[model samples]
Structure formats: C-alpha cells, structure tokens
Target: MSTQLSEDEIIQKISGNDLTIGSCASQALTYIGNKCGYDVRDFRGADSRWLFGQYTTSQKIAEAGGFVECDYNGFKIADRLLRNVEEGKEYFYTSGEHAAIIRKTGKKFEYLETQSKHIDENGFHPLTVNVLKKRFRTTKTRKLEGEKFLQKEVLIETSKISDSPNFKELLGYLNTDPKNQKREVPK
Candidate 1:
C-alpha cells in the first residue's frame, strides 16, 4: 500500500538520505515530489525509456536482457528517475524559490519545479521541455522522415490522462505534434 507523508516529513526524509547531489533519489523522494505538487510522470514514459537507452549504453544492454520490467512495476516516478540517470539526464530537486540542485553531480541547474516564475515567460521551460526536446530529437525525431523511420524506431512517449499523471503532458510538449501523442500502451 502507498504511504502518504506530510511535506515536512518528506523533506526530513530527503535530508536524512545519503542521496548524491544530482543522482536520482530512492523511491521515497519521488513520493515526496508527488506530495509537493510537482508532476514527474514523464520519467515513467516510453520516451524516457527510449532516450535513456540512447544515452546510457548500459541501460540499452539491460533492455536487451529484459531488465525494463523494473520500470513498469508501478512507483513510476522512482523508476523513471533511475532510468534518467542511465539515460544521461541528471536528477535534481530545489526549494521552490531556488534553482534545482543536481542530486548526484552537485551542479545547480536552471530549472525550477514550480510554474510561478514561468507564467510570464514566452518560451518552453528548460527544466521541463528542453531535456524532452533533446530526447525526442536524438532518439525519436527521425520518424518525420518517413514511415520507414517509424517502423524501426522505438515507441515515443505518448500516453493519455487517466485518473493519474503518467508523463503524457511532458511528452505531448516534446512530441512534434501534440495531438499525435498517444496513451501509454500497456506493456
């Protein structure tokens, strides 16, 4: 069963962990992101899996061996975070007012988890959209070339909004055509 923790409790737990500055956190931390109102569903999507393979050869090798099931067992948020590490994208968290600090690298990134500062901004937020664009272009963008591209390519991140968040919004933005994004097919 899922255990719900208060924001303070969550923060305390995070502080207590030995998490590196930019590496993905244990599942406990992802649960905190959910409780704090951030949407991390994208980390759990097909696109993430594909890009991770592109970025982390180890993960690609793992996928070939059927290790991908570790990501599909629910607790998607945490699974996605670890996958992101394998994919070369770093993981981070921040105070709402500060920049996100990489958990493993100790580098501070420019993205924030909240939208409060982005409302007046005209461009896509780097924290949310840039990495996705990089992922799409590097791994999934060739499909625009022709049907042949689609046939050989790994599936993209496309999923519908069900009763829960599952990375659809992030993928919709990253995909070339927003309307083309599809609900995640059950594995």
Candidate 2:
C-alpha cells in the first residue's frame, strides 16, 4: 500500500484548495472519511441529516456524498466531543462557529482547517488543552498557549464519521446506481 502523508504533508495538501464557506461540512466529511477508510455512502431520505449539496452543490457533493449531520453550526456536537482526547488518535472538533479535524502528536495536538479558502491558509494549526483545568488554547509557541478555552465545543472520532465519501470519488457526482446499469458518474 502507498504510504500516507506525513502531518506536515497533509497540511500542505489541503492548504490551498480554495474551498471556502458552506463547504466545511462536506470537506470535513470527505477528507477525514477517505483518509480513515470510512464506509462513506450517500444518505438520502426522510430524516436525512445530510448537510448541503442536495442537487445544489452537485460537483463537490457528488464526489463526497455530502456532509451528513443534523447540526451544521456544530453546536450540538461540540459539547460532547472536544474533551478527553487521547494520544495517537484523530478527532473531529466542532463548535457553533467552526469545525476542524484534530490529532495528537506526542505532547502536542495539531488540527486541519479544512474549509478555509485557498488564499487563507489556516492549515494544520496546533492546539494544547489545559486538561488539568478543563480548558484549551491554540499554542502560538512551544511555551505560549494563546488565550484560554477558545470556544471548541466538541470532538468526534474521525473514522466514526463513516458516511463521508471522496478521493477518486471526489470532484464529481456520486454513483449510487444499480451495478447492472452501465454508466459512469457525472455523465
């Protein structure tokens, strides 16, 4: 199998994709789901928590099958997932304001700002939690942790978000047709 991207490389890969607002949810689902090997299927029906893309954001959504969740702002997710992150694992952090994927690298934690516009590079930023006091902050320097409790609301297991589809499946529409049907996606 091919080697995975180093953390630095992953930051570089997603830094300048030009994917901006309203795309965060979709981008999060696809990139994380693909990297973590989630099932990543399309969910369409009543009680469909699928966020964005419908017949709307066709190009992006088709490739990734849309970001599925009830809360786009992530208010519902943040309160539950942001605490108790352990080492060697990846987590998806969310709040009413923003969402990003975070992981542990030894004593420090790094995150991917997946939804920023290409020109605004907020990729692979680091965060340090004051676990002793139940608070966290973005570390500016090794010795300096910026602010306190800077509004991260929750964290979710990345692979557990198994419904996001992407990679070769990206940049086009999803192919959810019967196998017997003979046609390529996005024809």
Candidate 3:
C-alpha cells in the first residue's frame, strides 16, 4: 500500500488530472468531502441520511461542492446530514433578503428574496438541509462541547474546465467505457 497523501495535495492532483477513479480518486474525493464538512458515505448516499449540503448563495454552495458549480449545490444538500455537529442551530434556505452570513463553524447561510423556484406548502422554495443536520443534528449537549469546524473552500475548477475546450475532450476520455478501452492502469 502507498503512503497516504495530504488532502490538499490529493485535491491538487485530482484537479491536475493526475488522479482517476482508482484509489487516488477515492481518497481525494473522501478528503474533499471531509474538508467540505461532509462525510463521503453520506454525500454518496451510502449512509441512511442520504443527505447533501445546502447554502443560500450560489457562491457558498459552489464552494462546498468543490466549486464545480453544478445544479446540485453541496452546502445546502449536506445540511441535513451535518446539522448536529455544532449546536441545534442549522442553516435554512428561505425566500428572504440576505446575501450570506456565517451561521456556524464553517457553515454559512444565504437568504435570497427571489420567488420560489421550488414551491412548498408554506410558500417558500424547496430547500435542501443536509449540512445543518450532518454537522449539527443534535440538541444534545455532549456533541456541542469543543467541536472543530472547517471554513468552507471555494472551487473554481469547474469554471476553468467549462472555459477550456480541451476539458470536454479530457472528460470524454475519462468517462469513456473502460471495458471498450484497454484496462492497463493499476488494479
């Protein structure tokens, strides 16, 4: 077995295309998930909670999702899973008038005044609440004592990939059927 690499180095290697879905990719993804205050098992829907993070601002959510800026923002989606890490307080998305604020350790809240893109019975847009729960799902006083929180990091890699024509080709190559292609890489 190879010695484990640091989280930042793993992320850098993954972003640089030196990593694939092999052990390197798995470890990198795990580290990335953890750094974003998410458990890989939960984000991957392996856990019973099946939660992802939630954030009000596109920026914060984008940051949490390793900055890929996909339709599913990481912060808001992970809220439900991490809601109990700090205290009973959790970030909630609603149709309100605020941009962004640090609601907890590394968690943030962003309120938008825009109309509900996703309407619910209460008249507010549908919200994802994973981070809040995963990181803070308890009113229990025990988990609240001296917990460590990570500041969220922004990932600009997606924008870089989208802007580069070569990226599409690279992604295509990476996503191609391995069975059809040669499987010469490490097992």
Candidate 4:
C-alpha cells in the first residue's frame, strides 16, 4: 500500500537524522521513494548490486545512490525557466552538480538545503529559492552550440501524480520550453 506523506509527516520522519555531505540527490530521492511502502529491501535498479546497495527507509538516505522510480526524464531547461515554476507543489531539480527540493507554497518558493552541516535535528534547512539560485549559480551559462542551451537537467516523479484528474494539464503547465514552450510527454 502506498501512503502519501503529508508535509508535517515528512518533516517528522526526517527530524531524527543529520544529512550527509554529497547526499542532496540521494536524500531527496529517499524522501520521495521511501513513501512507496517498501522497507528494508535491497535496490534492484540498474545500479551496481553490492551489499550496501539497499533502499533506505524514511529520512535515512543512502548518501550515494539515486534509486527512485521516475516516469519522465532526459530533458533540460534554460536558465530563465525558473520563472515558470508552478505553485502549491514540490519539485526536485538539479544542475548536474547539486540537487535540492523546491516547494511552492502560497506564492512563495522554499528549498530544503540538505547539503548544510548545520541542519541539526531538522535534517534540512528550508531557505528561499532566491538564495539557492544565487548560491548555486554557475560561473558560466551552459549553452549549446546554437540557441538551445541546456542549463539544468530536471526530473519529476510522475508516479506521485499519475492519479490526478488533471494529470495532462499539470504536465502541460510544467513545460520547460523557452520558445512556444511545449513538450508533449508524460509527467
């Protein structure tokens, strides 16, 4: 049985541990995938199958592996794409270097800083996305040979929204296309 975690439930589950270094992506994936009702099992993904390659439960992150099951991937957006983020939802985005969770609540964007060592009992430090974009800003913009430059690769665990009545509309709203800005794909 899959149980979706409420915001408070997620916070409570993660309050017991301190996030590790270089574990941002793992931590986010663990948080999203741990709610899938599987516990204490070895990961069967395409990754290496070692003794330590196990699917951690709850806020307990693997620190190295991103083993979550996602539906859509292999696309990126321009730097200006951040302006189009939808509200009242959480997103996991990465620039091929660092990763974090960006949540929009009531016209505000908050990101969970999992890379900070000072997170203490919270296991995360929630900050404004403006701070995140500034802190994680790259020295040079990642542009392709012509005009379509891929800035940051993005991913969304569509399994979380497969049952939505407006699934198709939601996917359309998340289009990262710069010009005309519409990509036909599963969300």
Candidate 5:
C-alpha cells in the first residue's frame, strides 16, 4: 500500500482521531511527512512526545525534501505559507511552544494541528503576532566563524535547553565569555 496520503486523508486523520496527548511538533511533522510521501516514524521514535525539539524536527523535515523557514514575524509566515502553497511544497511553522502544519486550498489558508485547544469550530487559529526587537543594539566586534554559523543560530533559537539534548551543548560552544578567554600575544 502507498504510504503517501492525500490532503483530505491527512485532514480526516487529524480531525477524526484524538491526539490530545502527544507533542504538537511530532504531530505536525508526522502529518507533513506523510502528506509528502515520507515516513515520519523513521525520524520520530515510538514515543512521539520525546521528539519535541523544533530544530531537530526542522532538520528531519529538510531531510525529507521539505523546506523550513524560521521567523518571528507573523506576516512573513503567512506570506511564506502562501508562497509554499503556490509552489506545491509542504511546510511547517513553529513558534514558542507550539507547532502546526499549514495548507492552502483555493487561495485560503488552513491549519492542521494536534492540540484540541488550538482548534475550534473554525479550525486552527493563527499564532499571535509579536514583533521581536533586539534588546541591545551594538555593532559586531568580530565576524562569526564556522561553516554552520547560520544553522547554529536557527538551532539555538528553536531548541530549548529542557526539550533539546543538544541545546545546552550547542549553547555552551557558542556562548563564550570574552573576559574568560585567553587573548593572543602580540609578536
């Protein structure tokens, strides 16, 4: 039997079943992967709740040939969702403690989420809009190093120390105290 499911099939699975206990991230990832012809079980383990890290989930989606966009702007998210729909690509949106799969049908956007609280008679509600501003405005003292600098930033922003095992390790490597660092001696 073909593992790939149509959009309607996925929607029926979401609406008809009770997924109130699992992690929203895993549910969204599973829905997106299944719809796009990938097996979510391979990436997410038996207990889906344990795979709640956004960065890890994003990596899995990318590995499955899907695109991931991380941004705090709601308008940008909406625009990207529309663009992805136009291109017939599957995408997921993650913010704070919640994640959801976005779909476009005839110019209208719809969401399929596992959390019953997030869904109502009208379907999934849009995330709250919050404009994130940097608390400190300062020029960069030095350029970032490493090949995965950008990827590391995304990982840090999405992964929490409690949920993601690699979060603390990555943060420790990235966050170094300038005062404690040994400066190079001038020749």
Candidate 6:
C-alpha cells in the first residue's frame, strides 16, 4: 500500500542520510511518485539515462510523463510556492545547475533535495517548479531549406497552464500574433 508522507516525515526520513547528494532530485521525485501510486521502477528507468549518457533531470521527468513545464517569475518564487501549488502533485524546481522538489501539503509547502555531504534539512528552494501531469504532443513549423514549403516537427514538448495571477494577462499577450499586432493601433 502507498502512504502519503508529510513534509516533516519526509525530512526526518532523509535527514543525515548518505543518499542525499547529487541524486537528491531524483530521490525526492521517486518518493513522491511512489506515494502517488506510480511505479518507482518506471521513474528510475526514465531517470537512468544519466548512467549511459547525459540528460537533464527535467528532460528525464518529461520523458516519464511525470510533469509539465510552466512559467513563473523567479523573483516571486516564495509567493508562487505558497499561493499556486496544489497538494499531491510533485513540483520540480531548478536554479542554475541545481534542482529540487517542492511538495504542497495542507496549505503549506515542503522542500526536498539531495546533495553531497548530507540531505538538506533546511529545505530546498529553486527558481522554478514543474508540476506533475500527463504528457501531450505539440507541433512546431519550421522553414525548409531549398523549398518554399514549411515543415512541421511534432515534438513532445512539456507544457502547462500557469496558476499565477498574471497568467491570464500573459496568455492574452502571447495569443496575439505579430500580424495582429501590426493591424492594431497603439492607444
């Protein structure tokens, strides 16, 4: 049976553990996935490419259909964590070269990460978080060389709708194509 662990419980379980190191992000993701009734082996298998070659943690998660990428201002990381995240969904946060997981529980957030020396008891915070979701395919059109026609590349891009207050505004602006912009007069 799967047991959903509280933030404190997760922290306690990982604190001072030697497994806390470079694989911390993967470990946290595995814990969350297992609790959510996903097969831990599937997650590990998707994350295993690191042993044979180089692939980003986010890339692995995307391949596993575990999370979707969304946009948020890095400056509002703390506010977004408290206001936007939902319970039972796993969030992946990355800053520069480091990555971690942030899980929401009962109106609060719990951060988890692994790194060399020890597990971060102080909690891990990253600039961005990707929430778990089902995967979907997206198509992008590109110009083909030596031909007047354009070609479409069907890519399995990770995508999500943002929950931020400004999300709608951003979406509206993004939906307006460049041709539409030129047709509209400035106020």
Candidate that scores best on TM-score: 4
Going through the candidates in the order shown, the clash numbers are 15, 7, 42, 0, 0, 3
Could you list the CA RMSD of all candidates, in the order they appear? 18.2, 12.7, 17.6, 14.5, 16.4, 18.8
| TM-score quality measure for candidate 2 | 0.44
Please tell me which model should have the higher lDDT, number 4 or number 6.
4
CA error at residue 115 for candidate 3, angstroms = 29
Error of 4 at 145 (Å): 18
Least lDDT summed over 10 consecutive residues: which range in candidate 2? 178-187
Predictions ranked by lDDT, top down? 2, 5, 4, 6, 1, 3
Error of 4 at 19 (Å): 7.9
Tell me the tens digit of each residue's lDDT in model 3 across 1-187: 2345554333332221112111222222233333334323111112211112223222433333223222133344234323422432222221111121122433443221111122221111222344233322312222226763333323322233234444233222232232332122221
Give the alpha carbon lDDT tens digit for every residue of 34-126 in model 6: 344333311112223243122343554434333333323222333433454566665654432334566567665555543223343334443
Best by lDDT: 2
In model 2, what are the clashing residue pairs, if there are any? 18-118, 62-174, 78-153, 78-154, 81-155, 82-154, 82-155
How far residue 67's Cα lies from its native spot in candidate 3, in Å, is 6.8
lDDT of 6 at 46: 22
1 or 2, which is superior by TM-score? 2
Whichever of 5 and 6 has more TM-score, that candidate is 5
CA deviation > 4 Å runs, candidate 3: 1-127, 131-149, 155-160, 169-173, 178-187
Candidate 1 stretches with Cα past 4 Å from truth are: 17-21, 24-187
lDDT tens digits, residue span 1-187, model 4: 3466665455444322221223444445444443443211111222312211232321122112222321222122313434545676555555434555665566665666433323343333444444545644432344357543434344343244333354333222221222321111111
Worst 10-residue lDDT window, candidate 5: 131-140
Off by over 4 Å in 6: 2-4, 17-21, 37-53, 64-89, 103-111, 114-120, 124-187
Cα lDDT computed for each candidate against the true fold: 0.28, 0.41, 0.27, 0.38, 0.38, 0.35
